[model samples]
Target chain A: MAYPLPVANVRLKNLTKQFDGVTAVDGVDLDVADREFMILLGPSGCGKSTLLRMIAGLEDPTEGEVYIGETMVNDVLPKDRDVAMVFQSYALYPHKTVQANIEFPLKVRKVDKVERAKSALAAAESLGLGEYMSRKPGALSGGQRQRVALARAIVRKPAVFCMDEPLSNLDAKLRGETRAELIALHQRLESTFIYVTHDQVEAMTMGNRIAVMSRGKIEQVGTPQDVYDRPASVFIAQFVGTPPMNILPAGSIETGKHLVGVRPEHVHISPEGSLAMTVTLVEQLGHELLVTGRVGERRVVVRQPAHSVVPEIGAEVRIVADAADLHRFDPVTELRIDI
Target chain B: MAIDQIRGGRKIGRYVLLVVMAAIVLFPIYVMVIGALKPGNKVLVNPLLPSNVTFSTITRAWRSGHLARALVNSSIVALVVTTAQVITSVMAAYAFVFLKFPGRTVVFVLFLATLLVPLEATLTVNRRTMQSLGWLNSYKGLTVPFLATAFGIFMIRQVFLTIPKEMREAASMDGLGHIGFLREVAVPLSRPTIGALALFAFLTSWNQYLWPVLITTNSDYNTVQTGIAALQRASLSQPNLVIAGTVIIALPIFVVLISFQRQLVRGLTAGAVKG
Candidate 1:
């Protein structure tokens, strides 16, 4: 390539999308820095995919604008936006050989054959797909087809990469390896990447900044640690963790709020604790234990290291939470109340 | 041992059934070939057998029927119709599936409603339209009315709908718009259905008897099908010539079906099967 593609930050201003009479994405405002890996984390129908599609120009927004670099691209055609997408289905041109698939973006750009072949080969070699260049997508395994899609995305070196759950189709092991590969690719290219997925593990592991969304609205946006440590809303507090945060009525501890939350790992069992709970179930992981029980009418989970003394089912235990670990929320708004 | 015996007996039964079916289907072809090969005087003597294999009747039928010109005209019409239909169907199908507009559903429904009106029902009106356009007795009369087909639109549309919507979006992000996506992705993936559609368009155009009979007054534009019918009437005294003409008329279809057997089957069963 004669010149490397310029890295561009992405901005969404009051972006909204509606289908029929119902809103799919409602008033989303975001800024993705150049070279930042931003993950849109939400459940299905939370409109993460719809938001990404708006930025890619695949969906027309019902209101507001999208800016790539300094250009307001709400009206720009997707092809002219200089963005590349990797679909979840891999969506490889099933009829084209892998080599041709990687060469397609360049071919569409009217890059000469000699240069197209050279860049395609370079991409294939980087992805360890040199051996499968002549094979059609159907002949390759799921993992290999995904690599071909990545090769195709990178061959042209677009300013932004919009991937819609690109690793969801791969098996658990293959997804892990591909995730590492993507991180390395991001570092090497230094271009903005907008990834959408419902998996929190992917969001926590891969994104420099995570936007947690629910019901067509962004609940909060922050770095992984920030969102995990101090969620802005009760939805983020519950949605981003395995077994999630245990939310209960703020009882008698003088918390001065209607509701309080604590992550499972933050709730611990000790003899001198304030709350008493009856253990109802036990989940034994090799490295830790998750004990589920009730404090009054509200159920909560406590994560304990394997070396710690564990509680048996049908036994009573005292649970404690450090004041620093307690998250207070306004019950009516479900938004965090900074205490 | 008992299981093996049951399996062996079933296999034999299947072979017997297949042979009977094959014989039943091939009987008409056998009669046509044998009748064509027999001499005019001996045609009724041993209709089941090749009594005297001769080329004289076939040659005379070819010349008298003017089948060479008929074959050329039919080929031109079928080829033109098939190519035009495929291109038009693909474009229309793409529009229906990918493009968004007001009244899209109503328009698609109206387009599909044409499929319910049998070709016979529209023949008279279409013929009148062609006549008013000065297309009578010309290749335009034979090919123009058939340049686009509703059945083709329906089949290709069904195939196009199966494509993941994300593929189009992905192509857009890759700097290829709708036209590029249709060329590089949609058409290639739908090759089987398109092949089937082409075979069908060619077959339907080639075998048209009523349309050609109504459209062409000049013998120069007579298709093989009309030429074969003319042979039957002119050779009332020479039955062998008529039989030979019938065989000649059937040869091209047989060649086409044999060469594109896969596509023909796929086309006929296009909506019933997934690619």
Candidate 2:
């Protein structure tokens, strides 16, 4: 049966959360479109998870409102909000088999036994967990356990699915595999997915729109390419890249009263270049080479193609980045400056 | 081969030590049984032997000591106390661990402070209170005083705390309210600890002697412990009869301990998380 699952639009109106005088989620406003895959990306302690929890009604906002699907859910209980959550630890009942775990939400809603069994079996089969229907969560591996958690959330056909680092416990290879599977599931079900993760790669790959947060506030919200190509602030530029963007002091660049940022891939090792550096280390991966060097007082890295000539560790090199590729930020405010 | 012989010798030594310890622990029970089986005239003679195994003294003890009524009274009181204690303990423990309220710590500490006051220290006052309430020689007097215990609260609270915070949050999101979560998740997860607490309350109430003697003057409300004491006083010349009463009182405890051994172990190690 092709279920017409209800999709929800989520809105946060200046939501704030404080724990013992420390603001975990400060006056943050966001809107998630119906059936959209929205990712909240940040480092640990940046309040992304707290923001999602507030939407789920697991945490009460200290100073604002949360609306889910046109209804203000601030005072509503989590279950009444018609939202499902996939926790970081999976949080599967240790005593329950996979089938029972999937059927738990349905059972709580007082669904009949035959209907519960049918829905649980369908969810499990879709997650490819049919063989593990009789196994306890402890008996399953981390990846399989996470699938059971996913099946449990979907069995009730919730409007919004809030996931808190659901793939963090898996190894790298499995995380990549699960990431694709989640995208496929989201597309098929067409339900709103609000995912939180500290890993920028996961955010860039999976989120239709990524909201980068830091210290209880949203730094920027945009499409993945928008965030990568034109970061709103130095923090976004530095936080969202692998071997993060090279930040140089204002004194080193001609950009007045502003710091210069260039991605590792944007910085080139050319004979006719502006910046001079001494190569210190070379990380040769199969597809790319990460070249680390010192540019005057600052440390810089360049991502070169694997076919490029490897530079000696102590060699002096000149690096250049196109003006279009450079991001200038006000040194004092740390906000981006359009030159 | 030499190493194997030494390992075998060590195993034998371990068995020998275990046998010695078991004998030491069981010696008193063995003596009580031997004494109970002997005729009153033969009780003091060769008390350790199995000779003259007459059960007339046991029958007399059961009849004259009013042990049958005493057993019924003790069972009712202990069962009531155990069930009430489990319910109160689980509810109180859940509130302490999960629910947030003002003065929570102060209230918890005050509750814990009750544990420091020995039950013996309050027995007299409790007996007097029961007398004033006109509940003396009644089941209410025996059971109400022990319907809840601070130790039970502390134990079940610790077990509840071991359940991760995420589980509670997940349950809430899964449409399970506080009472639903308690019934479906919290209580089931803590079955072992609850079982242990129930057994503890039952055993303590069953073995109560001082309070029963203080509040229960009528032999109809006499529990097993106090009934055994009365049997001792009445049969000073017939020691075998007292022995027979003691044996009967101790049998139920052994049966309970053996039957609930697994739950007892689990409850004792309640906070140890299993994968």
Candidate 3:
């Protein structure tokens, strides 16, 4: 059977970056298929953003090569890279009107008046910045400014789009709306997107393939399901989930398995399975209950489904999960178990 | 009532201070006008007002000093210098701020260091240079040395630093090289500072007296300041025309100042804070 061709496969081979006396991105290799929404998720000071900037050609890697499609763009200037970036700052020119800011790139490229307007209009409409065209960025609301920023990036019609925490500057509700819109927008455009964020929830929701990076090194790269269900390392397990994965010591239960990873949503109250524990505290989130307690010497969190009776603070409860669903890891190496 | 009285006392105190400062600042100008308006004989009397001022005294000063031609010459010089200074400074500032060329920072620092050297110090050397080029008394000689002022470049560079790097990056991403990006992106966004700098440049050029007097021996190319000074000598016989010429010279600059007061204040504040 013939398989559909990937849109643009990006391959980075042994990528390394250094600044001043310090190394930032260290020996990372990755391949992202065309139309893939790949997220580099990490904590602050992690080199994930630096790696994205290298991909955007804003920074040059000290060693190795980066391939976008089949082109090795190691020394290529940022402008000719045919990629656009949205900054965490939103980086909107404060003085220019929304229309002018969005039209800026097109204008520089000498994209004629009619075509520039049409592209800007199309981008603005989709991003919901249509009515505020003539208003300066300083006058617009944060959400509107963000939309204008997004429109400015999209109007370029680039082959690749790199966003460094584009939703981070927004409030919670607007971030959610913009996130959903971004996903939809990505689907409609069918362009390759490399999103860098520290927020795992954003990584989980938006990325098809998630690369968990820690301290300038990529811990794991996999499909969201693969990474979430079978995290390559303890870092990936803990980094890819909301409220994070609960990594508790299994302690000789399984050989080479010093820790077993459990998602909060997957760990349940069964009263008979796994081990018995007394709930020290409970948090009700309308849709779920977060039961925190001690299982052996390990602190475990179990998510009870909504509408379930809330367990008392001191009540004894049993945290349950299938051994098959458990992701086991070595505490020393923090690498995933094959079993 | 006591609180109201205290507030009223402070308000009155502030008004008194302001009025005193204004009078102190404007008194010299008032003196010059009175001196220019009185006949040479009445000048010794030096009355504060123009009560007994004669039109004939003013007319004799106009004829004797040839102030009309000097006024025209001054306007042209100021206009030319202002345009040249603004354009050159903007280009130099843009290059320093945005482009990466060999020796750029060194060049910029050298340019900025010139701000410490007084404009008068350069007058002798510039006049020699002008004479060598056979440009003495020409408009080119009048305006050339004043171009590319350090103040204009420094002020523009201040505003340029505040602009988003992303805009510059975005512009570059669209195949806009240095000059292209400056014109297409940076310049348009910097309009307010440009207007502010333009006013500053105009003021500097229009008020310049020493260089114009030193360089241009021919009376045809004399600027407002030099022309007015020469007018003072002729109007020793008649003060009215001299006062009128002083008013004429001061009017344009005063109007320019009043209309752009906010911009001027911002420019001054921007300069002080930036340094």
Candidate 4:
């Protein structure tokens, strides 16, 4: 690898956090490019939040190093880290009005009233919270409260914005709305943003790059398409999609050299195919049809485009995927086999 | 709406239960007010309401018994005690919850373990410790021993625990020192619980009778609570005057109770929930 001229926003080298005797975050390395929207995507206990907190300097790394720009911030207190975080619960200062909450960082840095309000107003307006700047978090809707939280984080024009499931508290529709707002906000600010969520949909939609974490280590780090199209391992392939990527013990050990993977969209009714399967259940989503069934003892799922003539649940249909679409993994290692 | 629609004998039973509970709650308080207002001879009647409830006995009690002075002393002491106690508890709670240091958990466990070893059982050694400090008969004597209160620390610490680690991180990223973050973010987010704790501390300090009586011997140095008990002993036979002073002594607390009534309930429930 050659050096890129762009300075990395935050670089983690083997960052780790251990609690008591348990390793909560194992050796993990990551680079968040300047102005990039990177999501630390993983299930709970995967150490994603721990990584974000370490970057914010809330948690000290038990091992390894964290860099904000060129400085190693191993011992820096969170307040001096020049980062801002928005929590899953919004975690707004409920007693303070939106304006006061946004102005808090400035106040702590001893920025005067006039400048604090001006910057707070800009951040608040950027998040479409201009109309409700005087309201308390308790008085605002969940989405509004989340925006206020985002506003508070960006008001400082910080070098990094760390968000831990900031949209998790909202209702489903509101989650979608606030997520879009977050992306737009990221673009306009152009500061490094590291978001954490267990939801892959959020990771897929928002992150310019996504770091897939599992059990305290990075499973894969790439663009949404990169991780989705070429998952580095079985855990990621299964973890990154809805209805999860189905796994089957291969038809034969030799065939396992070129393993099988079919995206629900690619799993289609084929009049001619090699494998035999029995249909067990059918799911009709408005836009697509999913056929779940068994090939021997192993379960397989096939998803097809909506409004197309799809097979019935009791119908034993032949299905296949293009050779390029079929992913292969070493039978023993489970690491992907590049063609 | 479901409850309203729930009609019949069960509903009647609920109404009766509600009335009984309300009466149970109000009766003792009603009796106390009547006892305070009744003329000395009429006090034995235990009237439901005050008769001849003129302000004279209150005025007489307020002046002759030195109730006014006692009231002032309790106000000042309670105000000082509650502020010191809450601030200390919040700081202690913050340190225990957020900061990591060598022996930190052991120290927190030791502090919490203080609650198990009853303060009543430790009074002898505690009193000796105070005397050695030459703090007897002083506010330090009264307030110092009560600082780092087990309950205050427990309540504030419980509230501090639920504040997600993210807010603290956010505060720090904002370049806030620990104290700054506590004041600006953690404290504000935990305001309802803190509100409740402040009220609880004030009430506990104001209502404290045994500690203040043991520490302050002189009448003028007395807290209203301790002073009222002294006034009773000095004039054992004067029930009406004593009751009058009691009512006066109870007034400020009543005002605080009414004003911060919401927080008292919230504070208590928050503590209960956290525990």
Candidate 5:
């Protein structure tokens, strides 16, 4: 990176936040390395956003401490925390021109006019918003407004960037485009990026590591492949993959006291397999066919190539998965177990 | 074809109804202008028709009513009141909307409760306070009592609530303090409502009749409203003179309303739709 940004790692220790009597973010501890793009991934109401807000200093934690680099910043104001945030709503100043919105941070810090204009122009141009500099946020499209928000966050070149589902408002196609742009921006700035999202695809594609959360708790933190392949718990195993992992009762496949877990892609139909299922439905998703069926009383989905022969509804079929692809979780604890 | 004819007939009926309503509203202004143009003796005769037109009546009324001075006095008071009310209202509304404090809702309710108390109810007490402070018959007396209104605060706050909470958070993250955010974001975003408030404040202060009559004894301190009363009292024989005085005094308000018509509509209709 050519720019000199004050890159710093973020560390949270025993952080907790409660709204009224309900706990939104429970005691949690995590560390993000310098310039690492860490993602907080979860379902809605899972407290990933609350956790991100605590780190950004927008929301105060009820307990514990937040560390930026080596300094404890629990008492510091958001302005002094050296972190910029891109909100889900974009939150660009509606009255300010795109150029002025980008320059707002510098303007508040009393930067000189010439330097502010230069930096604003450079930021806008980098975001491909050079022509819309004079336009208000109301005049720009949703994706362009999101980019302007990104430009505003980057203009000051803070140590850490906090994005709370910044691309959620954009259409799917635009979201994909901005996802790539954000990755490149993170690389170019060489700054710590902590992103919060409920989309698993975004977590897998954009994050260097994903912290999966549920019920105000971090279930597991690992790389996308690690979390997908060797999830620490059944919750993470189901949450990190499309169509989720199928969980069958104990002893459904082999004699065991644990539940069996297998990914939809790993489940296959075979003529000589052991488990028998009745086909219920099939969804053709262009390149893949999602075959849903009932194995005993549990519904299971299997991913097959689009070219495969479609099974008739209510027809019996044998299903099988390799032992290596199977995951075992204790039925009572819901935690993974090794043979 | 029958339906089209019926629709056309209904449209013409609506136009006719609108014309009648407009005429009813404009009749008084028409009478006033016609009355002002005629000599005092001819005013009562053929009041609806303009005849023996004389511009001298307006000039005479201006001189005898001390209208030039009155207009200046009214302008100063209205402008000062408008500016002060806008500042106070915006600051108060921002605090009520954004700042966290104890008893915030109770305090805001108490503030709004003042709106139910009519100005006439507090007139005597306010007059005594102004007199004790020696603001009577002065610009201070005219403008100070109405510098801030609860209605203005409530109106502006309604508009302010429409601003997303994320905007304030974003501003804070960008290093803007409360004042910075209010000045740079909140105020500019609420400009239409503020403009409407300013117009309302100016008109209210400009047309103040009872307050100005109660506080001021000196003709030198007379506002346009009080000056018009004085003109009527002095020119009992020349009724047109008083009418001309009113016509002159109303010009500024008409101009203000016409110029701010767009803002007024937008501001009034604000909060009617959820953004």
Candidate 6:
């Protein structure tokens, strides 16, 4: 079975959603190119899920226009929008078998039974769920249930796929494996994928571009490396990394009226460095060490290779980053300063 | 060794208590069955015993009481009322739980307020309305007043609230309208509660005595309860006949309760434990 490539792009212009007086998604503008895998990444309460729901037509926007390809769909129903969504809960029918769950969308469209079964079987086999077709979701493992949800979403071959943290329920090992499978699926399906999650690793790995959101607004939209190397704002720099960027007072580094930002990997202990701090904790992460220290009133962490000499707790150490590796941000606006 | 002996004593004591309770509850039923089997003359002689066993009394009561037709009529009324109650309750519960309308809470409160009004208070008005509609001695009058119950709505609504909102949204995304979702998803997921409700409605409708006696005057429309009453009045000297009639009427209720016992327990305890 050959999958048809989608030619539709999703464009959101000044989309806003308010619940009773609290604005959930406020004045957000974004465009997902045809066949592009775009991830909406944010912390909890940041409106990433709400924005995804609005795009899926499960939610009505209080204001703004949503365009799929060339048609604006503000008043369009969810089914008529030609978009499928995979929920965080999976939302598979508990009473239905895996085969029936996959066939439900097709069944609702009045597709004949034979064609429905054929399509459902193909989708199930594609997801390695062929042997589990007769099982209900309650009997399946979390990863299998998540796969069943994916198969259901793909069975219809909608133009745009909206995923709301679909892999959050899986264990760590299975999450990694399924994350790779999802990337492969995006490539094979060749459809626009708009995924929402707070896990920066997922956004960095699977998305062609990540839209970093904060407090109901888009902070930055860029590639994984772009957001990492050159975060547009203080929030992006702190949010996009594992230990997060080390934000320090300007006087701690070079003389400037702005704050300094440095990645954990770039901060190192050196005898000749300028900034001095007391090492409070050291965590050995098998292949690396996370050294946390306190400078004045702020805490900073430095990631060092396991082979490096281990620092002693309560020992005073000087940390430094090369001038070229430093990022500057305005203390007032919190926006990045290029110079 | 000491602990084992104490545990054994406690277990034996528990079984003894359970047996005593069981005997107490079943004593009346045992007497009824024994009296139903004995002839009218021997009913007062050793009423606790099962001697002089015979089916003649039950057979005689069946013929003289017109109970076969009464059983058929009661079955029809109960089945119709049960089916209608289940459907009406599910639809009303769905509206209460899923639909957005103005004054929804107020309307639900009003529906609940109907439950507070005792059935006796509405009996006079209901009979008058039935009379005006010329439905006396008909199945319509026997079943229409109970087709939709506020208690049914409230019980079903509690079960329906357990269905996550995501299921409805998922159904919507699958292109299912309200009716389609209700039929394919809502109704099926709520089977246990509906089953329990159906059994309850059937038993309630079957056991009705006052309303059926008041509204029904024709012997053709005699229900099991009314038929049993008439049998008691006609055979005052032969009290065993009425006992036989009661034993027969209880057979269907027993079968229904046995078959639906699992659903009743599960549905009654649905939300007590959260997954």
Computed on C-alpha atoms, the DockQ of candidate 1 is 0.76
How does residue B155 of candidate 2 score in lDDT?
A: 92
Tens digit of per-residue lDDT, candidate 2, span A205-256: 9999999999999999999999999999989998998999999998674546
TM-scores of the models, in the order given = 0.96, 0.97, 0.86, 0.84, 0.96, 0.97
Pairs clashing in candidate 2? none
Estimate how well candidate 2 is docked, as a DockQ score.
0.83
Q: Would you give me the overall lDDT of model 2?
A: 0.93
lDDT of 6: 0.94
CAPRI level of candidate 6:
high
> Which has the greatest TM-score?
2
**Reference-based lDDT, residue A168, model 4:** 88
Error of 4 at B129 (Å): 5.2
lDDT of 1 by residue, A1-339 (tens): 222767999999999999998999999999999989999999999999999989888899999899999999988998898888888999888888999999988998899999999999998988899999999999998899999999999998889999999999999999999998888888888889999999998999999999999989998999999999999988899999998999988664444756899999988898898888999999889899999998878889899998777778889998888888989888899899886
Mark the regions of model 3 whose C-alpha exceeds 4 Å error after superposition: A1-7, A249-257, A266-282, A293-300, A305-322, B1-46, B52-58, B101-106, B120-140, B234-244, B270-275
| lDDT by residue for model 3 (B84-159), tens | 8778878888888877799998998998899899877877887888999999888888777877789889888887
- Candidate closer to the true structure by lDDT (higher is better), 2 or 6: 6
DockQ: which is higher, 5 or 6? Answer: 5
Off by over 4 Å in 1: A1-3, A252-255, B268-275
Write the residue-wise lDDT of candidate 6 on A14-49 in tens digits.
Answer: 999999999999999999999999999999999999
lDDT of each: 0.90, 0.93, 0.81, 0.80, 0.93, 0.94
* Docking quality tier of model 3: acceptable
Q: Compared with the true structure, what per-residue lDDT tens digits does model 6 show for residues B27-87?
A: 9989999999998899899999899999998999999999999999999999999999999
Model 2's chain A TM-score stands at: 0.98
Query: Distance from true position, residue A214, model 2, in Å?
Result: 0.7
Which pairs of residues clash in candidate 6, taking residues 3 or more apart in a chain or in different chains?
Answer: none
Each model's DockQ score: 0.76, 0.83, 0.49, 0.60, 0.90, 0.86
Q: Per model, how many backbone clashes are there?
A: 0, 0, 7, 4, 0, 0
* A104: Cα error in model 1, Å: 0.5
